[model samples]
Target: MDIKQLQADIAAAVRGNDVLKCEVQNALDALSCATPKLKYLEIHVLKKDENINQFTNDLQECMKELGVLKGILPKVF
Candidate 1:
């Protein structure tokens, strides 16, 4: 099949499905695990305080996004 047709099929399938709570929770858990290691590495190994701060902030934003998605998905689907 052509790429365009394959893309359409995948899109259609995705639109029909609901994102499970477990999936979103798993993502949050991963971010929680990574954030600390990232912070420590940035402080000790990378020795880039600014980068660590930015990375931590980005992680926080991602967590917020996932939390919102988690809350909304149940209502949506």
Candidate 2:
């Protein structure tokens, strides 16, 4: 309505936009920091999965050997 009131409103809007921009920039910076950590976590999980698979294979082989040994040896009650 009045020029002074319009100027005040514009100033307030500008300040609000600046605050929002700062918050967006902060969020982007945080995401940048987290990206590498997330990648490292993914790699660590994959390695653990690989180890689990290897251990599972080893256990199966041991079980098979035990079965063979059992068949060759006589069982005493």
Candidate 3:
């Protein structure tokens, strides 16, 4: 579930197809950006034990995006 591994998988999957490689690269860029932000917030901003519900929702949404993207590869190839 780590972003780096997922990125590597995507890169591998899309290696032979230019269009798919572009799309997968774009997805990976977005994931790379989002993952750091999420980690920063989780470690620094959310340390006071306040409003965990919102953090949980955000975390779920992030994971859901990864899940959807990961799911698409099997169907596509």
Top TM-score prediction, candidate number: 2
Model 1 error, position 56 (Å): 0.2
> Which candidate do you rate higher for lDDT, 1 or 2?
2
lDDT string for model 3 (1-77, tens) is 99999999999777758777788999999999999999988887656565687788889999999999999989999
Each candidate structure's count of clashing pairs:
0, 0, 0
lDDT of 2 by residue, 1-77 (tens): 99999999999999999999999999999999999999999999999999999999999999999999898787543
My TM-score estimates for the predictions, one after another, are 0.38, 0.93, 0.39
Q: Report the Cα lDDT for residue 10, model 1.
A: 94
Query: Sort by lDDT, best first: what order?
Result: 2, 3, 1
* Candidate with the greatest lDDT versus the true structure: 2
Q: Write the per-residue lDDT of candidate 1 for residues 1-77, one digit (tens) a residue.
A: 99999999998778655455568788999999999999888777656767788999999999999999999999999
Give candidate 2's TM-score.
Answer: 0.93
